[model samples]
Target: MPAARQHLFLLCLLLPISLSYEIQLILVNNCNYSVWPGVLGSAGHATPEDGGFHLGLGEEAVFDVPSWWSGRVWGRQGCGFDGQGKGSCDSGDCGGMLQCKGAGGAPPATVVEMTFGTDRSPLHFYDVSLVDGFNLPVTMAPVGGGVGCGVAGCEVDLNVCCPSKLEVKRNGKVVGCKSACLALKADKYCCTGDYGSPKICKPTLFSHLFKSICPRAYSFAFDDSSSLNICRASRYLITFCPPAR
Candidate 1:
């Protein structure tokens, strides 16, 4: 084969590898206590760390996810796993297991969501969502991903100010805050049925309160205009129980 043809063949063979980049995520537990981080990859995607793992106070966990990975991360508190990894948590429990293993955490749990784009569309979208309610303060910030990469999270503890009706208490102490949809189970609050569309599903009083406290997070389903953040970064820092801003 001619030199030019050989070079073209090599390029073709390498194209797919170049397109499938890996993204690094550094998850830190900054809370005063230990936290079990739960991961739930989107359908058909690979779940890292077997879906969950333990992170002691001041400790961190790192993983390299495919650029096409889309998933949600959350923290489980007050957990107790037996020798066989069978146990539960006061908040964010996933089927009473230490390793969530593809299971989603039980709300009310603070959630960090990320959807990375493939080579065809390289933008990464992320948000700290309170839609399932808040178990702890958390933040997701890009590392050295140039300007326009906004941070998404809530720095302040929401459980402290959680409304009485939405509080998830454990042992007489508030551990999580439930969304109105979870607390009331009303179609209007859940944005179901007649209130499904963005136009019809405006923010409710509870969501408005959440927005006021955490402006950078998703207070409801239609909070895309402000809560959704876009960027292109290979590394992200997700801190649970992040310091208050």
Candidate 2:
């Protein structure tokens, strides 16, 4: 074979391995009951696992997300879906569909957001957010620890202590906790108008309570720097109904 042809063949042989780096997300359901895992990819990103799937108690689903993928994941409880995938959930329902596709979960749901690395940037960013509210406990941690990689999530079940006015009830039970912003929708609570920046939108009493309970999770808008985590890892584990700390 010609030298150039030999070189080209070798490159082709190694290309798949070189581009095989992926972010493996293991979604584990640790609750006593079954839960449906909902996934929503960011703009231009592809939702994996058909966007949603059912996970019985103690079951887990693994997804191989391409590098640079950006998306959010959450859990839905008490969902009743027909064969055609049409249904409603007690919490975190996405347009009455079993597969969320690109649809985001309803408010009062705990969310895990992740952005993987790109060629220009190698750092992966991830965080658990309670800014919308909390329906279930969640935790996100790298499979293998990397330098400066920190776990982010709310290990405690916020529903137990959810304020009466901010509680979302289903069958006379608190199914989810509502953020003051979602409960009130005021500019001050939502961090809008003049209170849009980190400098101005300081944590409120409610936000402070959430932060105290889940210090690593994002409690409100502009809760960056402290809540946002940067790491580089090949795999991450997201547990629903995470064990209490």
Candidate 2 Cα misplacement greater than 4 A, ranges: 1-17
Model 2: residue 203 alpha-carbon error in angstroms = 0.5
List the global CA lDDT of all models. 0.92, 0.91
Query: Residue by residue across 1-93, what tens digits does model 2's lDDT show?
Result: 999999999999998678667789999999999999999999999999878999999999998998889999999998999999998999999
Q: List TM-scores for all candidates, in order.
A: 0.94, 0.93
Span of ten consecutive residues with least summed lDDT in model 1: 143-152
Off by over 4 Å in 1: 1-11
Q: List the residue pairs that clash in candidate 1.
A: none
lDDT of 1 by residue, 216-239 (tens): 998988886688889988899999
